[model samples]
Target: MRVGRALPLAAAGVVALALALTGCTGTGSHADAPSPTQTAWTEAPTDSPAPTPGATAFVSSGTAAQNQPVFDAAIRKVLAKNAEADGNAVVAALKAAGFPMNATQVSQSTTSANLKPGSIMVGVKVGDSCLVGQWGAAVDGYQSTVAPVLGSGGCLIGGIPVVG
Candidate 1:
């Protein structure tokens, strides 16, 4: 009789263990629901102002010579992970999107951390040739900006760090 009782208790314990392992399906650990007040844009704004056609006349805080190496290294990393042409692609995309940027003429700053470790910024000529810079945040093992260049994978155009 004791053996029979022991068998039922063991079976109950196993069932409990299985339920605990599976966890509750509702409100699961990985669930990420956006708040209701947020509105997702279905399309880009048609009335938005067009981008500028050429590079702008803006003075960065630092000089190109001082920060070239850091910029080059950042570009290399971006390209290596992004099909070895992510830098060019990013520049092309910016041009296509009305922010004409020169990827080949990479520059850096001196006397400041314009391209810093945790953040990076890529400059673009916005409307009427005004300079508009797009910044990037370090994501996982990569640096990604909000607006990617042409032929690049995503909207993150550049990862060149700001050294100031």
Candidate 2:
């Protein structure tokens, strides 16, 4: 009789320990669980449109694509007002307009010629697609393509031009 009682108590203790270790006691919601590896690219809100096909390979979305034009126009307006704006200013303007900071990359010109009135490129990653805008002394335009999340260079169609 004593052994039987001890066995049931020991079994109960083990079950309790298992439950405690597994966090199954209703202490937290499923959202509290650890998530898999996520890059900055995966952080967009759930409702946005899926990344368009071939956006990473430097292929144009063609003339009918509206987002690129709108983004380009916005950036152009800012640059028109202040040609000396740098990468940080462009990025700040973009973020204020609700662009996700995690999914955006901004590169500024390093040489004196590319400085104020130089060049700045801003790339926003959507899924595997990228929307890039460039403005400065040497370039002014936008391109929609497939690009790395942390994009570099001018994203110019023919590569960054030699700017003096």
Candidate 3:
């Protein structure tokens, strides 16, 4: 019968497929094989210079005008570490500078075209005011500002929150 004939052919095809798959197992490294070539520390280095004692302390209970300098200094210091840092890095720098995460906002690093943007905004809400700044990419070393919080109660018009 045609069904009976097809069964053996199908079984042979399965066996052939199994044998073919066995070749992929050989892709694993063997102890006898040479190790990968030495890799230089190519990526951005994580280790940063020690912060100067009492450097640019954040004014926790101060108004946005009182804290804008601290916020600006914090971003500049981090950018000194990595000039091409993303929006998250800028936010992290502000966080490390004692800005609360929930009060922060950072814009997307890349545009909708999947290309690096001219600059990305970073902000930290201090009381009723917001500390907002733009940096990176085509930016020529930016200056941050202190402004009233937007109608959305955020410094940025459209951006992800720092806590997010």
Higher-scoring candidate on TM-score, 1 or 2:
2
Cα RMSD for candidate 1? 14.2
lDDT of 1 by residue, 76-116 (tens): 44455663233345454443433324422222321165434
Report the error of model 3 at residue 60, Å: 2.2
Model 3: lowest-lDDT 10 consecutive positions = 41-50
Please list the residue runs of candidate 2 whose C-alpha ends up more than 4 Å from where it truly belongs after superposition: 1-66, 112-118, 140-164
Give residue 74's lDDT in candidate 2 (0 to 100): 54
Residue 130 of model 1 has an lDDT of 22
What is the per-residue lDDT of model 2 for residues 1-164, given as tens digits with 9 covering 90 to 100? 89999999999999999988877557667687888786744544445443354232211232213245445555666777777677676666666555556656666456556435455677765444566776665655333344443344323333332211
- The models' CA-based lDDT, in order, is 0.38, 0.55, 0.78
TM-score of each model, in listed order: 0.22, 0.43, 0.62
Q: State in Å the error of residue 134, model 3.
A: 1.0
Identify the leading candidate in terms of lDDT.
Answer: 3
